[model samples]
Target: MLALGLNQFRKEHFWLYHVKPTDPTTYAAVGVILLSIALLPCYLPARRATNVDPMTVPRHE
Candidate 1:
């Protein structure tokens, strides 16, 4: 779902998309936008997450 949404968004916005196609500029713009959108989820923070202690490691005794 997320993948589809971001893809459409990129095509519409950054690409200045066209119906006939064959425009290199539009294609390049779309590609760049899609890549950026794909990376967005990896970098964004969770809405309700709290910071954990740096010194504490999980599953280690």
Candidate 2:
């Protein structure tokens, strides 16, 4: 829904940029890049946490 709104807004201001606001390739590329960026930090920590013993986590508290 937000993407649609942004796209509509961008379409209105389309002359300001080179690429089309509704381009699927650009949207896909950006979505992948953003998803990776968002997931990386979370994944790294969770991956590291999985290596620890469940009992050890309680001991620290």
Most TM-score-accurate candidate? 2
The true-versus-predicted C-alpha distance at residue 20 of model 1, in Å, is 5.5
lDDT of 1 by residue, 1-61 (tens): 3544567555655445444244566667889999999977865654323465545646454
Best by lDDT: 2
Judge candidate 2 at residue 54 and give its lDDT.
100
lDDT of 2 by residue, 1-61 (tens): 5776678755867646577776778789998999999999999999998999999889999
Model 2 has a clash total of: 0
lDDT (0 to 1) per candidate: 0.60, 0.83
Candidate 2 to truth, TM: 0.65
**TM-score for each candidate, following the candidate numbering:** 0.43, 0.65
| Predicted candidate 1, C-alpha RMSD | 9.4
Clashes of each: 0, 0
